[model samples]
Each structure stands twice: as C-alpha cells, then as structure tokens.
Target: MAKRAPGLGAVQETMLITLHARARCGDEAAARLVEAIDYDFAPMQRNAGATELFHVLRCAALDEWTRQFLAECPHGTVVELGAGLSTRADRLDNGTAHWCYVDLPDATELRRALLPDGERRRTITGSVLEDGWADAVAADPGPYLFLAEGVLVYLEPAGVRRALTTVATRFPGCRVALDTHGEWIVKRSRGPLTRMAADLVWACEDPKALQDWDLGLTLRESWPLSRPDWVVRRALPRHTRLTLAAVNAFVPRRMTNSRVNLYSVDATG
Candidate 1:
C-alpha cells in the first residue's frame, strides 16, 4: 500500500481510485494502489453524479483489453502515461515483464506515496513532452504497449506528435490505446458539462489526424452510448453478454456516441 501525505487534492485522489478499481479483477498492482492511498474514495465513487459512469465504463473496456494484452504479450513492456494513482500494474503485472508508470514530477511525488518505486514494474516521473523521459524509456528494448488512457488530449498537438514519434522511433513493435474528444463536441456544446470538460483538457478538431502524424490508426472503435447495440456491450463485462444483447435490441438511436480515438503505434524502426 502507498504511504500517505498532505497536499494531495481529492480530485486527483479520485482519479487514482478509478484506476485501482479498473485493475481490481486481475490487477494486483491496482488493488495495492487502492489500499496504499491515504484518502477515502467512497465519497466520490458512491455518489450519484460525482464520477462519470461512462468513464468507469471506459475503464472496464481498458481493463479487459489490458488482461488480454498481457496474455498475448508476455515479456512485453507496458507504459502508462499520466499514471495518476492508477494501479494498472496491479491488473496487468507480469513478473517477467516490465511496466513503467510515467507522469509529471508533482503527480509523481504524490504517486510515490501510494506506489512502490523501483526497476522492473517501475515509475518514471517526468513531463510527457520532455526529451529526457523518452530517452530513458528508449533504453528498454522489447515489444512495448503505451497505454495513454484519458491523457492524450491534455497535451497540445505538437507535444502529442513529438511524444508518439519519440516512442515509435525508440521502441520496436510498440502499441498505444488512448481516448480523444471530437472537434464538433468541443465547439458546439456550451453546456455546463461541455465547459467542465474543456477546463480539464484541451480539445482537438480531428482525431483521425493521428495518422498524418505517423501514429498508426490501428483500431478505430466507437463506444456509441445511444445505439441499438450499445447496451449489451456495456453489460457483457460481468459475463452478462446475454443481458447486454437483450438490452441492445431495444436501445434508442438518439443517444450520444462520444467518439474515442484509439491508435496502435508500430515501433519497428
């Protein structure tokens, strides 16, 4: 468990819990992160609208993906950017493999209190835009998976481009999976939720532009929340595949399909 300290914000604390929860099923590292945090996550998680349901759903999808990846990529290294208290290591830890949790210095300081630090499933603290961090990661030679989660959009386009290029050039056979916001969603919406989202991260006009930047547009899957086939997909996690299918049959067409951009970077240079 992580040792506790003062000055950590509740919002950051909650984000950590989300990561741990996603890692709960098979991610022992994630579970350890939860137990390590000094703050209470119940207030945010249990509340009606404190945390976004869709975010949790996204976490579910990623958790499933992480487990499947570990099964297929033994000895491959996995790196989590902006790894705020996320125990993805707990969920995807392979004793023989390497896992690097990277983030900013302040967040790293806070994370150190909640996570164990050392090589082999280690944590690297630095701004994702910086060159030094990439240089360090480039030292690891193996099939790598860069899991950015909800972090890509926070970076300006140049930073995002540089980071991806750096990784692709340094590591061979590396893949990345991350979420993105639609340009339309950002420009058209003026509601409270829209503004709140903008306050949290920068917006992009086109997610598909990733390919132009040399990042392979691997699997462009959409998690449409309002389609006839959406409900069952969400329900299948608890092995409620049948229930999810049943619900999908009756779902409406008007629901918002928040666009998620996932890319797979090939690091074979």
Candidate 2:
C-alpha cells in the first residue's frame, strides 16, 4: 500500500507492517496470519531498504519476547503500542489471551483493513500517551507488559512519559518492555551515518527519565535483541549479520525501564 499521506507520518506504521511481512513469514502459520491482515499502504515499502532491516529484527525479537511472556505469565495481555498494520497477533495467537492493537486513528484505519473488529483481538485507536484506551482494555492481574517497539522516539519525550505513567497507573505492578536509542543520537548529529540512524526521532541519554514523570516503572533488562542466527540465514547471507549489527549498534545496549516500584492506593501511584 502507499504510505499514509505525509503529515500523518505513519513511519512507525510502515516499519511494523514490513516487519510483519518479512519477519512473521518465518512460519507458515505466521505467514497465513500476516496474509490474513490488510496492510496500510506504503508504511513499510516507503522506508524499505537498510532501515527496514531494523524493523524486521525488532519484530522477530518482539515475537520471541511475547512468546516468552505468555509462557511465563498467565493469560497475559499483549498491548502493541503504535501497532501499525502488524500481524503480530497472527504470529503469536494463543486463543486464551487478549491482544490489543494500539495506534493513531489513521493508522488504525489502515489496520482495520486486515484486522477487522473482533472480540479477543481488538483495536485502541489513540496515542499511548492518552487515557481511556487503557480503560478499554480488559483488566488482567499485575505487571502487564506494555510493549513499544519502534514508536517512542517519534513522540515528544514528554508524550512518552505520559504514556508510561498511564500504563504504570492503570496496571499496577506491570513491567514494560521497550526499545530505545542511545545518547549518541541526540549528542552527535552529522553525516549520512547520522541520517541513516536518526530520521525524525528523539533519543534519551538516561533510561530513568520515564521515572522523572513520577511513573512507577523500574528497569528490568536492557540487552541487545540481536539475532545472529536469523540474520545469517537470510538469502543475502553475506551481509545480513553485518547489516543487523550495524543497525543494532545505534540502540541503547540495555533493557531500559522503570518498574512498579511502589503502588499508591490508586493504580496511578
């Protein structure tokens, strides 16, 4: 599909679907699941090339992490922050859990093309920074995993804080897993390498900035979600590892987060 008209800036949307298309294709069930969802135009293709590889790698990591979470947590809810045209539900559908697609209204419009309105799997068409959307999700036990794959940097730093604060409040004791960029992105802004790495986004020098907003999230793990095996297996085997590493080099090296350190009487605490 063509990219969403410029201003809507569906860069996250495009990246997710391309990741869905390329990464989810790993298994037949996943491929069928992806084929089942309709993709927004151009969100993936418009930015395909090297940058898209990061999208693919991240999607794979997300899929693996989701699988891990479900196996570990009981009937957990998987909230895809800025879930644009991604068939993540297809790859990791376990019938018994809840899967919510979160994103802007326009991106959801593109998502509805394939996802359809449903029962177990549904859509929350709003920025994660907003409220109400959390209320829309069915309540589960403590420590919900709010995942933000490639959406945070595009948001104003404060917007990200608001989103985290909301999630931390709504789901007390919830742990979040997200990917973020490093200090170098904000500090060094020059050359094609910078352009290749930084294209319309912001990075954080310290991971704890989320806590500064009074959100009760704590850092869990911050390791590279790199997959040397998968990269080596790609058709262009020659450059896949090098390519993946080059992209990953820009990511903050640890699992940066703030946990539900202490819960106030209100979930918002």
Candidate 3:
C-alpha cells in the first residue's frame, strides 16, 4: 500500500506542523503520536532539522513565560486561541490555574481526542473572531494569559486588529504571546523558511502599529525566533552558521522571518 498523504486542513495542518517539530527534537509524545495520525511523516520529519529546533525553542520560551505568569497570578486563567494540538497546558500546568483551549469545532474535536479534559483544563469549540469564548474564560477567576502561536499570521490585518483589541477590552490585565511574520515575508509570500509551511497572508513590519490600535496594549517584548546555538553548531551547514553569526552580530533586527511577541493589556482599555 502507498503511504498516506498528510492532511492539510486549516488549523489541522498546524497541529501536524508543530508535532513534526516536536517529534524531530525527540519529544516522546509527539514522536509516538506522529505515526498514529495515519501517515508516514518521516520525510517531513527529517526535513524539520533547523525549523524544528527553532519551533521547539520557541515553545520552551512560551512555557517559561507561562511559568512566570503562574507565579505572579497563582490562580490565573490561560486561553490558547487557535490551540491546535498543543500540550502547553500540560507542560505549563500549575496546581491552581485554569486553562481553556479555544479553537474551531473541528480542531477542538481533534484536541479532545488526544488529550482528556481535567478539572482545570477544558477545550472550547469556538473561534477567537467570535465573542462568547472570551466570555466563558472571563467566567473563571483570572489574571489571564492568552497564546496565539502560529495563529495571527493567517488572519487578515483587520481580523488581527479586532482580536487584539477585543482581548484588551474584555480581559484587562491579560498577557498575550503571539507569533508574527515581518512585512517582507508577508508581501513576498515566498521565503525558503515560510515556504515550508502554509502561506502566511498577514504580516506586520512595525509592531509599533499595534500599540496605536488604541487598545492600551504595551509591547513588552518582540524578539526574533531563531535556532538554538547547539542546534546551529550541530546541524546547520558551515555557511549558514557563518551567515547567522554575522546577522546576529551586525544587524539583529534584520531578522525578518519570524518573531514571537509578548504584550500586556492595560487594566483600563
């Protein structure tokens, strides 16, 4: 029998994409589940080298941020918009915090299939574009944290704007960590790195524009997402390694491919 093709539906594709990334980095759950998804993803998994390493590192950074948020707001609620198949709640679980994984109905079904709901964790079938999901999250006591990883880039500029403003308006004292592409990638829609995944139709060259949304959002940090040092030393070609070093040394901000931005919403938006 021929190998089954990987499913590439919206939202569902990201689950596979992130799973491939984690499995490539030897995440046991990701590794075990990849094959069980009914496809031979070995070729895609093999190609995951640097991209996988960077994604895994990005996830680690988010996990750390969540840890800090939990420490500060011990009973905080976390809402993961476009949750896909992420195990972040499991990875970042504090004993008291509540987690809601929000996504379209289909994706939520897949999420529920893989991970059972617990006392503190539940999956909600809904879109961030809609209103009720956030309200449900608000019903729980919170100093909230929202994650939009690999999500906003797919939304149009207006949709992204509305989503951000809505969060600020509805959940004051919330923190959001989202991934975005630079204008170059958004306009060209053709980069070696981005070409590996689904096309990212939305991009923001100036994160400062987001602040101007009049949503009372503070740009806490916007950092380039890159492969870890050990991954570079171990896996990258010699010239690629040299090029990365030069970029980091001379023009770090020119890293326009990928970024993970963290923002804080004002209590009086």
Candidate 4:
C-alpha cells in the first residue's frame, strides 16, 4: 500500500473518485489499481452530485483530443501537468506518442510506484510554476498537448500567467487544456473532499480573457463542468439545472461554473 498523508492526501481523493467511477463502469485497469487503496469514497459520491460524471466526461473529452493529436502527429508529445494518479497515458497509448507526467515530488513518487515508466512515458518531478519541467518535455520534438486537469486554481493569477507564457515560449505552437473555477466557485472553494485542503487562489470569469495573459495564445474552447450528460443532469435538482441553462443562454462566455478550457498558441519565432 502507498503511504498517504491524512489531510494532504485529501486533494488526491478526487482521483480516487475518478478511478472508482471508471472501475464501476468496467475499466479493468482503473479497477485493478483502485482495489489497492483503502479509503471510503462513498462520502464523495453523496456530497458531490456530479463529481464522478464530470470526471468521466472530462476523460472522454481529453481522450478524443489526444486521439485527434495522435492521428495528425504520431510522434507528438503529451504532457500531463499536476498528474496525480491519472492513468491517461496507459489508457490512451497510441504506441508512438511520447508522454510526460509532471507533478510534485511526492505525487510523482506515488505515480512511479503505481504506474512505472515505459519507453514512451516518463515522470518529471517539479512544480508547474518552475522552469526546468518545461525543458524536460522540450526534448521531444514539436506539437505538444499539455493537460492540467485539477491544477491552475491553486496558483495565483500571476503564476498561472507565467506558466502559460513559459509553455508558449518553450513549445511554441503547443495546445493546453486546463480546468479553472469561476469567481463564485472560488469564493466557496473548499475542495469537494472534506479532508482535502485545497485553497483555490485564482478565479477567471472569462477564459477568453486569458489571451491577454500572453500574446501567443488564444482560447480555443471551453466546456462548463456542469454540462454533463442527461444521466448526470437528472441527479441535479431541477432548479439548479434551470439556473445553469439560464446562465448558459444569457452569458455564453462567462464562466459562472467551473470549466475545462483549451488554448492554442502560435510559435514565438
């Protein structure tokens, strides 16, 4: 069993929910690994109505995005920033794409133990705010898709901007997909798991505004977290659904809910 810190491990519990959700849906790989963990994730399901569904949807979106990349550029690189216990590389391996997992030392250590490296996949231990990690991925030639799943919110606005600019400068014409909370979500931003001590420091109401952070980048698309399938929607209260629909209709660009956003940056040459 992997040693775990009590409160600190709380943020990682989000990944556990993803694993459990996937496992129940007959993902053998996710199920096999999830069986080793000893944590009661039931509370997560009860408290967070659509947590599992959102993860499933996000994984599906990322899978398609990754497939599209591999189809175009077989030798393309994929970087998972703040990769906790995500088995995305294993799940979406295209046989030729190189994959890099970047995270803090402890998280990377855990990842190494759970999912050992292979010829095309490796782990880099570092903060996304730093310089060296970008260089680590730079070894692989052109066209990278950086996925920052549950990251970014923990960073201050300046740090987020710096990271984005650094990526654009380093990889040039790379694509980035990340999740961010809105102003309202940030105000009440306690992590979904009670034990997880996540202090979300930045909130962007408009993802398009991120373009101003760096000249090379432009927001490609944004998918609201609440916009799950009908099966998940039925779990939400009727009023909540109505309100979200109303918000979607009124301010299409405003991120009243958390969203996964994609950005494309031009080469800085």
**TM-score of every candidate:** 0.71, 0.68, 0.83, 0.82
Residue-level lDDT for 188 in candidate 1: 49
| lDDT digits (tens) for residues 164-265 of candidate 3 | 877999998799988777776566543123434566778777676688888888899766665333532455557656755665677546444577778999
Could you list the CA RMSD of all candidates, in the order they appear? 5.1, 6.6, 4.5, 4.6
lDDT of 3 at 86: 80
Q: What's the distance in Å from true for residue 242, model 4?
A: 12
Q: Give the per-residue lDDT digits (tens) of candidate 2, residues 53-117.
A: 54555566666667777777757788878876667777677877678888887777766764586
Better of 2 and 3 by lDDT: 3
Best by TM-score: 3
Alpha-carbon lDDT, every model: 0.58, 0.58, 0.72, 0.73
Off by over 4 Å in 1: 1-51, 183-198, 204-206, 220-222, 225-255, 259-261
TM-score of 1: 0.71
lDDT computed for candidate 2: 0.58
TM-score of 3: 0.83
| Cα error, candidate 4, residue 235 (Å) | 18
- Per-residue CA lDDT of model 4 for 79-192, tens digit only, reads 988887777777778888999999888778777877888888889988888878987888876689988886777779888887787788888888888877778777764325
Model 2: how far is 82 from its true place, Å?
1.0
Q: How close is candidate 4 to the true structure, as a TM-score?
A: 0.82
> Rank order by TM-score, top first?
3, 4, 1, 2
